[model samples]
Target: MTAVKIIKVLGTSEESWEDAAQAAVEEASQTVDDIHGVEVEDWTANVEGGAITSYKATVEIAFPVHESSGDA
Candidate 1:
């Protein structure tokens, strides 16, 4: 059986939830490969002047951890 691993990340943006979510995936992609998917487990925002000033996204990024080839 293959081992599975999971990690949680919080990515925020002043724009929208999509951006916040994308931010997380993009960052994770830099180091983690073969990202299966990202789930918006939770979300919150900062309100200012009766409007959303910032958006925060709680994402569950799931991916497989593979052994490094070490063929540098």
Candidate 2:
């Protein structure tokens, strides 16, 4: 059996929506393992001087939960 978990995270980038989503997954991987997939829930932007200064992405990261040795 496989156990999974989902976490919501926010990431921003000056590049594009893809970069923002990638950044979120990269940052999460620093502390998380077995990353399965990412679902982009929402997108927004920071506007400055009639231009988009930054792109923001809200993602749901999914990963497998490892079982402890003591599990019965």
Candidate 3:
């Protein structure tokens, strides 16, 4: 049997929304393993002086759940 866990996280980048999403996955991978996929929930940006300053991305990260085996 196999199971997966989904987690929501926000990533920000000064470049683009795609970069932001990639950043989220990269950061999550540091702590979590077996990263299967990612879903982009939303995208937003901050504007200053009529220019896009930063891009933000809301993403759901998916990874497999590992079960521990015990010896009896």
Candidate 4:
């Protein structure tokens, strides 16, 4: 049996939604470990002058929790 945890994150990019999503995961990886997967919960974009200026993505990242073993 394994334990898993989920955390929500927001990422923004001027490129595309995919880049936003990927950015979230990449940023999370910097501090998090054992990352399993990611689920995009929502997406939004910033519009300026009738043009999209940035993309935002809300994602849920899943990872495994480390269990402690008695060693002392």
> How much does candidate 1 score in TM-score?
0.82
Cα lDDT of model 3 by residue, 1-72, tens digit: 789999998999999999999999988989999999999999999999999999999999999999877756
| 10 residues in a row with least lDDT, candidate 1 | 1-10
RMSD of 1: 2.3
What C-alpha lDDT values do all the predictions have? 0.86, 0.95, 0.95, 0.97
lDDT of 2 at 46: 97
lDDT by residue (tens digit), candidate 2, 37-60: 999999999999999999999999
lDDT of 4 at 5: 92
Which residue pairs clash within candidate 2? none
lDDT of 1 by residue, 1-72 (tens): 556567888889999988998888888889887889878988889998999998988899988878779999
Question: Candidates ranked by lDDT, best first?
Answer: 4, 3, 2, 1
Residue-wise lDDT of candidate 4 within 8-72, one digit each (tens)?
99999999999999999999999999899999999999999999999999999999998878777
Q: Could you tell me every candidate's TM-score relative to the true structure?
A: 0.82, 0.92, 0.91, 0.92
Shift of residue 65 alpha carbon in model 4, Å: 0.7
**lDDT winner among the candidates?**
4
Model 2 scores worst on lDDT over the 10 consecutive residues at 63-72
- RMSD values for the candidates in order, in angstroms, are 2.3, 1.9, 1.8, 1.4
TM-score, cand. 3? 0.91
Model 1 residue pairs with clashes: none
